[model samples]
Target chain A: MKLTINRNYLNDAIQQVSKAVSSRPAMPILGGIKIDVTHQVIVLTASDTDISIQSFIPIEQDQMIVATIHEPGNIILPAKVFVEMIKKLPADQVSIEVEDHFRTTIRSGSTEIQMVGFDPEEFPLLPAIDQNEIIQIPGDLLKTMIRQTIFSASTSEQTPVLTGVLWNLKDNVLKFVSTDRHRLASRTAAITAPDQYQFNHIVIAAKTLSELSRLIPDQNTMIDIVVAENQVLFKVDNILFYTRILDGTYPDTSKIIPQTYETEMVIDTKSLLEAIDRAYLMSREEKTNIVRFMTIDEHTVEISSSSTELGKVTEQQKVQSYKGEPLKIAFNSKYMIDVLKVVDSEQIFIGFSGTMRPIIIKPLDHDYNTYIILPYRTVN
Target chain B: MKLTINRNYLNDAIQQVSKAVSSRPAMPILGGIKIDVTHQVIVLTASDTDISIQSFIPIEQDQMIVATIHEPGNIILPAKVFVEMIKKLPADQVSIEVEDHFRTTIRSGSTEIQMVGFDPEEFPLLPAIDQNEIIQIPGDLLKTMIRQTIFSASTSEQTPVLTGVLWNLKDNVLKFVSTDRHRLASRTAAITAPDQYQFNHIVIAAKTLSELSRLIPDQNTMIDIVVAENQVLFKVDNILFYTRILDGTYPDTSKIIPQTYETEMVIDTKSLLEAIDRAYLMSREEKTNIVRFMTIDEHTVEISSSSTELGKVTEQQKVQSYKGEPLKIAFNSKYMIDVLKVVDSEQIFIGFSGTMRPIIIKPLDHDYNTYIILPYRTVN
Candidate 1:
């Protein structure tokens, strides 16, 4: 485009949209980023078949000047090559000039690079989502919700809807649930929305959620979420992340959760994670990742695992609190470790409703996080 | 062996000798590290076919006691497993006890790991090198010299000697030279050895030199270079690095380096490196990394490269000084950039002999570094 911009802002914008640009696109034009330049703002858009992203840059930001527009123009350059050139350019301000035949000249101080630009009309524009309703939420909380529940989604392709995280909103409480038949993870947060605003069982792909999380700011910035008939859009500051919603309805998992538990134990999260990691070595020898934990005495829980070729590993740690009947259970150490890693708390409470039921896990200090994992049957 | 040692010291020693341990050994016993414990010192040794390294831990160092041996014995432990266990041990002092049938028990705090150990007799002992001659040099200097020429060594195994850097010592001067037939890099340094102690044309494998460089201390620690008939040993403090010398004799590259030049240009080494890097893009486009440099005026040189498919790149900068007839030459920018990256001087001198001969590159403020690169033929 016929404009001058700061190198840092432009670099960041290009990288954000590049997440949607595939190296080998079904259409050749999909490999490029559509650059739309105007006197007020410049928009960069890139899309794959499933997800699309658009980033905007204003002339002045935060009371400082970032770029100056000499002439308003638009052109699409090769994304990969343009990114590499912008990264190594040795100037504070970068200028792009498109001449006849769509020939583009990029100048930054003493370094000038000329590239053959493609026709802007061939590039796909941003998809128009029917944004009739929208809900605003904190960026940091949304990111945390995605991180906590997305990992529990199934990676298998047979059930396409299971590969997404389900979003359920009612009475201003937003809850996210993800399950792969064996285990499930759920997180909830309170949002300041209208009393009548409600969205039920909206499934978003795990991959798209992760990409949007990365684009969201780490701090407490406000993000606008717009749910359309077939697509969802997440607007964070000057960036808009859009993804297609899964067609099928998310299955109901509420009946599987238990209201009462046969046994519950509170233990230090750090020590439990470490003990499980140590037992992981033994699980490899056994051919199945089955690590068992049993309550012994009044204050300790014994964690042990065994392998036929390699030896067995056993260790006992003092549990903070234990109630109900003394019980023994076995589960995949990797799944337990992964769930424990995402829960940020000094102590965790694990609930068990007999040996056949799914075990419930929750941070003692945080009510917003909850995880449930099924146990593997072992003949001891 | 039965011993209690500082965890940090033991971990460092294990890592030092593990560099010589091969993932797939010719013999099963060769995969283990030989451990010999005595009241005074503990030794860790590992060897592959091409290189062997031994590290020793003394009873006391810098007025601090490192380890104490309760009983003196010898046993070999699996290198990879032992290293991993040592890294994750949760104790300040680690105790190792070997029992009958070569069963080893390692204890650190409450964590204990049992690993299967090989018999000491099965592990091959270190090869004895005849220490009749020795040369002492600074570890940092040796490391720098190795880095400057090792990159020029041929990666192809067709010519075994070309895969090594030649060491020539005479007239109280030591020079390192390496070439892949297309280009050659040579570095010379003055040593304080006896005049009669002369060694000429000792070629050591580039892979061995690189491994030894990583073990060398970053400071000015003096390293003892002991040359044997077929093996060369580098001794630094408690570590002994031994490597086999290449079998073939290195070819004489001295006659190919031109003595005089028709054109010499003194320019800022940093600026010239940056200019060549920018022109590097053009060479990639042309399918043959051919970038041309020509004197434009009394104090400026124009660097340009073009790709048939992509466009062209051109840049001009003022030279500090020029002493030669106006001429143009083309060469591979990658080779020029590699040589310039290793040179430490602020200003460098580039000399050209006509247009078809090799170009001599040396630092302006120093006389120790010299690199000669052959020019490529380009059609005008």
Candidate 2:
């Protein structure tokens, strides 16, 4: 393969694909990034058995020639070194030529790097998924959904299903739910999809979702997602991301969310976040990370945390509105903080059904997001 | 202690002194920051046995009241927690009150924190240094000198003195030298000091110098440096930094630098640095980090590195001037990159005695800086 391509474009593509390259691949060939040079486009692929990422660079883009191909071929190069070398290449235009025995020479400006490549046939083929039904979602909405719920996924592998976020699609509404037994986060978005193109129990690993989130554009571009029996594919612009669906069934969490509240309050998100943050500092020293929330009055609430060795922190803020009987609850401040950070609303609604029940938090102005945290049973 | 202080000022002072606070102190008290409050000023100090830093916040600065004292007292608070708490405090003005038994209450806005403070009397006292003669230097210059030589200091404790940078003050000139016996870096600056007040054999740990460097202001402000028999005190504005001198004799490195050269070349510092940086990436894979430099002709030079598994990287650049015989030498590219990063000049002069002799590098327009790197004995 011989071609001169725009260095910036090539570097950008390599970076996108490098995210799927594992530091410790199960096989030596799996560590290589497969490069396929065709007359129309150059495709770069990297995989670590769990997920595969492919990025394509076309011959010409926006009237400007991106690559001038003299020969068409394919080769697999070591991902780590190739990624670094491509980023640091000296010139705007870089020429890559693969000779006999897969010896590749990369030249840019006055610098030339010769690297040994592996045969493309040795690399594992990406799993093929039949795209009979495709679901379309805004890129920014997908990114937001992943960021909002991925953190709630259990990092422990004891229950493999809990490590993945469950994607539920029905009636043109896409819902993402993740829970770690102690807490749960759910986000829903309205998308344009055929009524028959609905799927449930489509769980994807939180790690793979996070990587896909990074690849998604920040703008309101549309992303095409295709789900098969055990494999899922996401096409973001010219990049194709594929990951295997996690095995096992996700536990049903609808029963945990309370339908009624004994007390509810509307509070400023930033103010409550800051108060809980300060209380968190003290609770962190105790390792329990328990912070107490108590209603001081109809318009005021107090947040406090204490450590035997470091002392106590207490703060009170005025809430917009409060109803029903006064209440007190204790919860892990870290979980609250995580939920608050992803909240994009100015005000939040918090509901409590006495002290022992799960505390529900939702955006005050919308019904599309919900978070539930189990309160810690503290001896008062 | 009872006082209402500006949170920003107190936070800055705490951050400055916290640099000396060790994560794992030999004694638990060493992990705390000592705070002394008087009618005139509030003093914050932190020590890790080897280094002690004290910062003073006066009652008023620039005609603005920094603190209002209601009572005078002292206490020691855990540095890590205190630092983090101060940063997240809720208000601009914070009130700190020490009740009976050293129980401190910090109030800001609607938030209140009660911390269990340790008795200041239990904290270790800083070593007293007698200052008969004082030397003055620009803070920026001292920072630059430390940055230029500290990277070359030996990190191993086998030779304790090599872990410290030797400071020789003579003839109103302060010279700093550091080496790991493989490479050496020296920087000198003219200072305002008494002609009779010359001192030598003063060695300070690289770690201490690094901390002191951070405390120094970037502006060209005058700094008072006092050398004691066993300690050195640097008074930068309202902050006093004291460090114990390392106990050992430094080896003489003057003999290692070549006096005359068999070949000399003047080159653009940035171009040579970039070429060597790229070559270093390939050499790093081989673990030896050896990059070969050879004279291509009167005005051109080649830099290259190779790995048995990764192949080779080669780059050629043009030099401004070249004299004497053409030669080839191999040296540690990492060390060369380190020196190039600290160089402030655009053009550099390189002098090589032969393929095996030590290579000398100096700024083309100044004589205050010098670096010597020994070439590797590679089998061609």
- Which stretches of candidate 1 lie above 4 Å from their native place? A62-64, A156-160, A247-251, A281-292, A304-313, A326-328, A353-357, B192-195, B285-288
Candidate 2: misplaced stretches above 4 Å?
Answer: none
For candidate 1, list the clashing residue pairs, or say none: none
TM-score of chain A of each: 0.95, 0.98
Fnat by candidate, in order: 0.25, 0.82
Tell me how candidate 1 scores on lDDT: 0.85
What docking class should model 1 receive?
acceptable
**Chain B alone, model 1: TM-score?**
0.96
Which numbered prediction scores highest in TM-score against the true structure? 2
Q: lDDT of candidate 2 vs native?
A: 0.92
